[model samples]
Target: MLKLLSTTLLLSSFIYANNVSEKVEDFLDDKFMENPRLKSVDVTVSDVVPLKQLAGWNAYIVDVEAYLKAQPKRLIKQRMIWFSDGRIITKELTDMQGGESLTDLVKPPFKDEYYKKENLLFGNPDAKHKVAIFSDPLCPFCKGFVPGALDYMKKDPKKFAVYYYHFPLERLHPASVHLVKAAAAAELQGDKNVIEKLYHVQINPQERDVKKILKAFNKAVGTKLTPKDLNTPAVIKQVNRDLDIANAVMVGGTPTIYLDGKVDNTKKKYLKVQ
Candidate 1:
């Protein structure tokens, strides 16, 4: 009976892996054209390990190694999450508290030094919940998520303190570098709402004029910022620091949020305010 039980378990594991593999392939096939550079995408689900029970949902983070048949035909590594109820999260996950993950791997170490007082853009400095937002000024998702996060924190001032970091995706949003640098410069000048206003502004893709953006920045944040302000040594250094921290944690997208230094993979924890 013991032998039979072991065989059953092995078979179940195999079947589960097979299903996950198929799902990943289906996802890639459907989203093939999402990236213009991809002539073809070949993905392999190397492993599917069960993770902690996440808020009553059985969750697992899958390891995917993909080959992008682009101009140079490059290979890439990615981690994706899968839920027992057919839900999938394609973002990276990290645990800053030194806890063991589902795969028995420790999350990347997060330094508290990174969240200095001067670096904070919103919320009470002494608040218990320290949230950090790494975002791009021109990202559409950042527009929605950044404001949403701030609004959520406002509800409980005593419990939450948020930090802001600029991560401009220049390849995608050409005007982002200027906007981010301007935000850093505005911060230096004590313009507290510069980043928030930038997020709220409506940007037309065809007319990505720097002068127009500067005018809007001045109007929204009550500061007459010019192109020269964005080129200051201090502003450049601050932006570089943000980029370095982001790269260490393998952040590939905008609006990456960390609550108390850990990557909040279950975004429901941060987004849904109870």
Candidate 2:
């Protein structure tokens, strides 16, 4: 009787795994891979594990491995949900408590020390509401968003704190590296408006004219920053640290904001012009 039970359990597990894998593959082929080249690529989905039931949903974690016919392969870890109403949601999940989202309990997709003192940009250091922004100085969206966030915190100093990190898109904006380093140096110098100055100066990132941009940076922020000031160990280290954090968080573009450690889905809540 024990041997027969073991055989039946193993078969059941195998069938369950196969069915989930097929479903995921079909979902990806139909909805995810939009590019023709990507659709043609081979995909392998495995390691489907049901995590837990929360509220009215069941959480499942899966590892998807994809291989291009003649290119490099990649692996992506995904969190999927199975709703009680026969709906499957991919990407993020959340829980509610007391008629509000329990954002503090939500496990962040990435582990980052964003609230460190060194990363703080503006507002009261002890404010309970923490906002972290990973942004590129040359990104048009960031020019308005980063400074706007700082301004918002300035209004409610007791309620919010802001941490800003540099993520220079060197491929698109070659001069961004220098500007980011300058921002780091300015932060070191206790210049509170480093981000605002950088956005206001409006130097073309593609120009790559370090001296011209440095001159503009100095004029905008009231700092006599030479090229040497940007290359100091502390400045470069801070910039590299920002880059490391951005990469770890998988930030795809500028002005990615996290409100209290979770990605803020509603921009209007935090970013609306006041």
Candidate 3:
């Protein structure tokens, strides 16, 4: 009887959370519709996880994607806080005694699969310290950070391992979609240095033409890969897998670094790895 009661409560909680997520989506849609600039809005509740309880309310970390009108290919992702007492709902929650925002305290823990051998870009796979980075080749910050991280691994190969994952901001750098795919294609062909090489290659961020993008990529990486090369099943699957991992981890932006499966917000924790 106790086990059955526990299972029933769990199901009830899940249904309630689902209802909350749907309500949040509807609220966003109605709010966005009021703006004349936005032709339409589609909001998706990606992940909802419980957070710490405050005074008399419970908090949840809600990750959402708002696809705006006229920008069908663009996604504006955001992390929001949902405070509820099973009767009232609010968006802000502050821990006065702790002196921290509730939202900042919540971070998605890394899954074991994130350390897959195939994703290792530098250093020994058995290194003592593991660094995972979700980066965009066209991102200005990633352009500087990714190479430096690679160099750090080179300096202490046994002490540090760097795993690279693609988190291209296609809305900002339209060329990155192709560039990341090209890099994946190159990796499939046994080119281990493709990630680092692509970071140094200069290309217009606004350029979206696939052929033009490949021309610059091939010239810089010394791989004469055609668009067809990037469209292969293996290459596509690899890129999609990277993207899925990024979304699962709630990677909001480029140059997101994780040290030993924990969020390294400063992105400089690898420098201290000895």
TM values, all candidates: 0.59, 0.61, 0.77
Between prediction 2 and prediction 3, which has the larger TM-score? 3
Whose TM-score is higher: candidate 1's or candidate 3's? 3
TM-score of 3: 0.77
Candidate 1 segments exceeding 4 Å error? 1-107, 205-208, 271-274
Q: Point to the candidate with the largest TM-score.
A: 3
Q: Give the CA lDDT, 0 to 100, for residue 83 in model 3.
A: 66
Tens digits of per-residue lDDT, candidate 2, 80-107, equal: 2322212464554444343433322332
The stretch of ten residues in a row with the least summed lDDT in candidate 3 is 52-61
Question: Model 3, residue 70: what's the lDDT?
Answer: 71
Cα lDDT for residue 16, candidate 1: 67
Ranking by lDDT: 3, 1, 2
Candidate with better lDDT, 1 vs 2: 1
Judge candidate 2 at residue 230 and give its lDDT. 91
Tens-place lDDT digits, model 1, residues 174-267: 6777777778898988877777787855555334678887776677677788988988899988888887777555566877888877787655
TM-score of 2: 0.61
- The 10-residue segment of model 1 with minimum total lDDT is 100-109
